[model samples]
Target: MASKESDAVRRHWATNRKAAEENRQDGDQELADHRWAELTTEPADVDYLAVPGRRAQWIVPHGAAADRALLCLHGGGFVGGSQYSHRKLFAHLARAVGVRALVFDYPLAPDHPHPAQVDDAVDTYRWLLDQGIAPEHILFTGDSAGGGLTITTQLRARSVGLPLPAGAMPFSPWVDFEATGASYDENRDRDAFFHRDLVRGLAWIFLGPDGSPRDPFVNPLYGDLTGLGPIYIQVGGDEVLLDDAQQLAAGAEKAGVEVELDVFPEMQHTFQMAAGRAPEADDAIRRMGRFARRVLELETR
Candidate 1:
């Protein structure tokens, strides 16, 4: 049985879903983005700074560890989300994990596609390295398409001989560009914000004319899973992307990588967006924080 708060969240998102559908029909991406951004609670105590060489914001939570960092990617289906929209959520996660988080914007699709997003992610990771943050002290995380980039960026980093981060946390990652996951249909009616058509449309825009859906950089589920560090994935049981998390966990485990996947029942996609307002979201962030602490070996204060 779902908690009362969870049920309330479901109702709220159902309303949001209707609005999103109407917004889409009206060709209002900006309004849809604004509506989604309204779900997050901004942190009043966190310091926001601009990265010198990248289009990124550094969200430094009070009392956070200066030596540890989280490279956070915001999810907007590779088209809409930005650092401002996700900065609060990233700040909450970073505060919980006792680290600063860098949330950056990359070129979105239909204008700049596939390789551009990956390139920006790789460049940001390199910038963090150059800032003297050790690879082992850093973690990567994001939601939706940004979640997928958490993995792809690691792959990109490895291709260029950059050291891998200590761990990753991908919340409701949109990893299957082919949309072959059974959850797409199984949870179709259960999920509020996503439908097959919307996902397909986003994929087309993000992949452009030259990109392949199966390219590991485009979809990390198809990438080689060997040699990556620990990964913790969280997905809503009601989300259409549930199978993406399941498959990625299975594939990573098969390749001898440490992986943990949590499926929250009766939750919507990226429910972590409701952080600070929902118990489930808070629990999920705490779990990720615990995982980050274990991987980074940060002693409890």
Candidate 2:
């Protein structure tokens, strides 16, 4: 029942899982440092900002003004990952779309739960506003679990009467914490880096005893997304998160939000990270860059 392309991606992930596990045990701080080092070769016009309660980094395109900004959220479930791991990718994204990226160091779960990550995301937007960036000129982007957080934060922003962002992009988002998506089973054998069981295990850890895996913050597809900004979700047809992406796309459309769902036939989750080594990866990133460029141009007009 698995396509050849999907099967190949699964093989790649199976081979890479050991490395992912090692990185997990090594801790986010260590992984972030290593990822940052790898990104030194593709440096951005970097700047730092010290928020009263948190810190953030700005990756701007060279020779470009900071007229537009994308508040980036990096994913490592809810307890792992940091801005460092995503520095090069964000820098490239900033340059590719000719916009600045404001990557934040949001607090993780167990230590900070449910609303913490959500609140931190809202706080990052506020930080952007305080620095003179208009809310209409800002967008939000994230991957995997961070993708869910990005949407959750947007909801929280609305509840608190905060200004809405211009648009959003969630790459292979882990949107359905309940893990009931058809792709969870359909693509189980096809996906490489992530499987339903692996996600559930980590989700349980992050949610703790008091946390409900079904909570909208943890599972955004169940939430009300009405009146939200334009959203583009990219997912691999072979990914276990394929269902999460699909369900969210449907939910967003039902809520009347402008939504675009891109299902790449043979790709895997986070393939863009492997772009330098994979042609499919390059194509995916280019597609995303083009999408973001369109959004940016529309916002400017």
Candidate 3:
């Protein structure tokens, strides 16, 4: 039931899988950006910015709320992805929510692994607080591996005594480092890329020699989920990670946290990357905006 534009996501992953299998993958840069570049119409209403001392870039939509921020940790299997690759995607979200967005970057795997990405995300978040953006006014958001980080980073920050943000919005999140989610098996043939082999390999690289894939800190599937902010999750129903979102929502709910999980049937992974070019993607963004606005206590117009 996906629209014609959905083909962009399919083609994007197909090309990535082809290159990866051939061992000719160009560090995953082109293929990763291709999803956003090919599917997203540039959001013309936002101004992109870089603070000299920060590890992130800002996508400030015109008339954005001065005190609110959406901190985006983009997805690239923890190996590759950056603000440059994700700016427009985040910009679209920022514009929808009427707030500024920070597209954060961290060192990639095999070069910087494990706690490194978590540390970077925490540091950027604290820096946002230091810059006068209130913790209650912020939301953590991202896709794929970044979506997983949106959860893990909050756990790390809480361990170090930082106040939790207003909420988190994670879509197509890759949270089950063990890849134990049944959706992986169910959607294996449905998903052209991200087979168990590829995902498990990424998990090992992300964990590094000192980390453990099953450790709650790294995987979060076994971690305590208490005291976190409300969570809103979106996942392509066709994704191998579908159960990741389901299990995470169930875990958060069991922990007494608020959870809203929206599954887009027959959609490809990170299909929200198709925002502005696809109705399904736009609908997803609208839901995120509503959740963020309500959680942040912004007056809904």
Candidate 4:
């Protein structure tokens, strides 16, 4: 049986689904920002710092390895999300992995559009590299749309001859811009948010008037996966995006890129947001930390 705390994610979405939709309709991001931050319990022994020359912040857990970094892309459907909203969540993961995290805000869609997010992501990555962090010591990670960026950023960076990170971890990634996944239908009743209509609307805004939903950088499921680092994906079993995780893993493996997929039964989208307050979320972070350590070639024993 799942722990009672597991239902917290489910309740969070179900309770806020209406308000979030209303916020979108009302053109307000403040509520969504506050709501997103409220999901995670503040982790102890983690310090936050502003990143110079960027709309980014560092989540430095006490005694974390100075040489390793977790580059996080905040997720809000490419339309919302920020460093402040995701700091606690990143802090929990950084603490678990024994490394520091850097989370940043990319321009939102319906205003900035495609390639803007990817450009910012690639730039942030390049900035990390410039900061003297070795590619082998950094891991690209994100949740939701940012999860999609975990793969797309590498594609964008590679096009410009940038070195790939050691690995990537995408939490409840929304990779299928086309929203053609069968899980959308299968998990419709189970998912409180993430209906196809909602995703289509967001994609339309994100892709803009000329953007192609099938474009490699916009929808990474259709992107080339060869030569990229290993991918670790985690999604809820009840999420409408379950197939997104499965499809991404398959694509990675087919291209000879290492992949690991974990579907947490009965959990909601991005359930890891409940870190520090839920056993399920804590377990997921631990698994992700282990994977990060192994791929980064850090001592795991």
TM-score of each: 0.93, 0.86, 0.96, 0.96
Which model is ahead, 1 or 4, in terms of lDDT? Answer: 4
Compute the lDDT for candidate 2: 0.74
Tell me model 3's lDDT, rounded to 2 decimals.
0.87
Q: Where is model 1 poorest over a 10-residue stretch in terms of lDDT? A: 24-33
- Tell me the spans in candidate 4 whose CA falls farther than 4 Å from its real position: 20-28
lDDT of each: 0.87, 0.74, 0.87, 0.89
Model 2 per-residue lDDT tens digits across residues 1-301: 3333334445545755767677645455775556533522354464444335566777767764577788899877887777777767677666667777888778877788766788778877877888898877788888888888779888888888888888888988887766777787788777776777778777877777788877776677667888888898888777898888888889999999999998887777765555444556556667767777677674355
Runs of candidate 2 with Cα error greater than 4 angstroms are 1-12, 19-24, 32-53, 298-301
Q: Per-residue error at 199 for model 2, in Å? A: 1.1
Q: Which tens-of-lDDT digit does each residue in 1-301 have in candidate 1?
A: 6555556556656886786777745357666666666776776678999877667889998888999899999988998878877888898899888889999888988789889999999998999999999999999999999999999999988999999999799989988888888898999999876888878888999999988999998887678889999999999999998998998889889988999999998888888888877789889989998998888889654
Q: Largest lDDT belongs to which candidate?
A: 4
RMSD of each: 2.1, 3.8, 1.5, 1.5
lDDT winner, 3 or 4: 4
Q: Give the TM-score of candidate 1.
A: 0.93
Poorly placed runs, candidate 3 (over 4 Å): 27-36
Residues 118-196 of candidate 3: C-alpha lDDT, one tens digit per residue:
8999999999899898999999999999999999999999999999998899999988888888888899888868888
The RMSD (Cα, Å) of candidate 3 is: 1.5
Weakest ten-residue segment in model 3 by summed lDDT: 27-36
Decide which is better by TM-score, 2 or 4. Answer: 4
Candidate 1 residue runs with Cα over 4 Å from true position: 4-33
